[model samples]
Target: MNGLLRFSRGVDWVNAQVGKYIIWLILASTVVSGVNAVVRKLFNMSSNAFLEVQWYLFAAAFLVAAGYTLLHQEHVKIDVLSSRLSKRGQIWVDIIGFTFFLTPICLAILWYGIPFFLQGWRSGEMSNNAGGLVRWPVYAMIPLGFTLLMLQGWSELIKRIAFLQGRIEDPTAKRAEKSAEEELAESIRRLAEAEADAGKKAD
Candidate 1:
């Protein structure tokens, strides 16, 4: 049990690091989109490569963040139903869902995704669009993302079981930590309030 807990923690750490780094991909994609739009509007010049690269980055960010989403319990849930259930009931629901639903889905994706990626790589697949990027790099994200997701599912399953066994606290408890976007929004709100207060004082 102790060893399983440690393994779960290690999987959590890997997903955490991957999630943190993947945020930069979103930023990069945004920057590329902005630049591409500007160039297209101002110069009336555009390339499929730029457009495709943006899609690739967006896909990479979305796919790679699956495990991170699972780790934070940010994945979609029917809280209206589940919230009405007892803690143990909810844990049981999660255990059943992860075991029966999530695991099989991820495994199926990996089974197909690996071959898809391999075919792209072997064929040196490129986009059909003019001046577009190669396809394998983006294709590879499918398997990689699912692998991470599957690992995190296992980690979550282990934690839920441990909780049920009285070896740990509630596995589904929400952490109070704010995300980066939340913190930034909070700072902006505080600055606005301060400015309003200063204006009132001047009046």
Candidate 2:
């Protein structure tokens, strides 16, 4: 149990670090997109490589962030019914979902995704679009991302079980501070409310 807990902590740390660093990928993508647009308009020049790199960066960030999202418990959840359940009951629900659903789904994707990535890498597949980058890097993300996510799932499973065994604090307790997703959702909700108010004033 202690060993498992240590492993879980390691996974959590890795995902947290990954989540922090991947924000740069998004920023880089945005910069590349802005530069591409400006160059297109100003110099009447552009390349598919520039456009494709932006997509690569975005996809890398989105895919690699899966484990990070899970670590923070930021994945979408329909808590309406679960909220009414006992803490242990909620943990069991998660255990069942992680074992029966999340595990199998990730395994299936990895089974297929590994081969997909390998074929692309072996073939040195290039994008059909001229001046575009090779496809293997993006293909690799499918398997790599899911592997990270699966590791996090196992880490979460370990924590939940530890909590049930009285070996650790409740894994499902509300974090002290807001997660990035929660903050983003709140910001979006506030923006929507502000827009609605402006519309009402105009009317």
Candidate 3:
């Protein structure tokens, strides 16, 4: 159990790092889309490559961030029924869901996705759209993302079990952590204050 807990922590660390870095992909996608839109509207020019790259970035960010989303417990959930359960009951629900549903679905996706990626890579599959990017990279995300998600599911299972056994605190207890939005808002506020102070000094 101690060994398993260590493994769970390692998994959590991996997903945590992934979550931290994947935010940059979202920013990159936004930049790409904005640039593509500006170029098309202003220059009256565009390439399928430009259009295709936006969705490629989007797909990469969205698919690759699955485990990170799960790790943060940010994934949408129907809490209508489970919200009423006792703490232990809720943990059991998660364990069953992770074991029976989440893991199997991830496995099924990986079983199909790995071959899908392999076929595309072997054939050097390019986009049907002219000047578009190759397809295998996006295809590869399917398996890679699911594999991370599955590992996260196991980590969550370990945490829940350890909690039940009195080896750890409640697994569902959210950490006292501000969300990204909150952090960004705070940073913006500080920047605004700094600019205001600079203006006063200039005066």
Highest-lDDT candidate? 1
Q: Mind giving the per-residue lDDT tens digits that candidate 1 earns over 84-185?
A: 999999999999999999999999999999999999999999999989999999999999999999999999999999999999998788889777456546
Clashes per model (N, Cα, C within 3 A): 0, 0, 0
Which tens-of-lDDT digit does each residue in 29-75 have in candidate 2? Answer: 98999999999999999999999999899999999999998988889
Residues 1-203 of candidate 3 have per-residue lDDT tens digits of: 99999999999999877776666676677788899899999999989988887787788778777887888898887799999998899999999999999999999999999999999999999999988889998898899889999999999999999999999998787899877556546766988999999999999
Q: Backbone clash tally for model 3?
A: 0
- Per-residue lDDT, model 1, residue 77, is 99
Lowest lDDT sum, 10 consecutive residues, model 3, at: 179-188
Order the numbered candidates by lDDT, best leading. 1, 2, 3
Query: Where does candidate 2 stray beyond 4 Å?
Result: 177-203
Residue 17 of candidate 3: its Cα lDDT? 78
Enumerate residue pairs that collide in model 3. none
Higher-ranked by lDDT: 1 or 3: 1
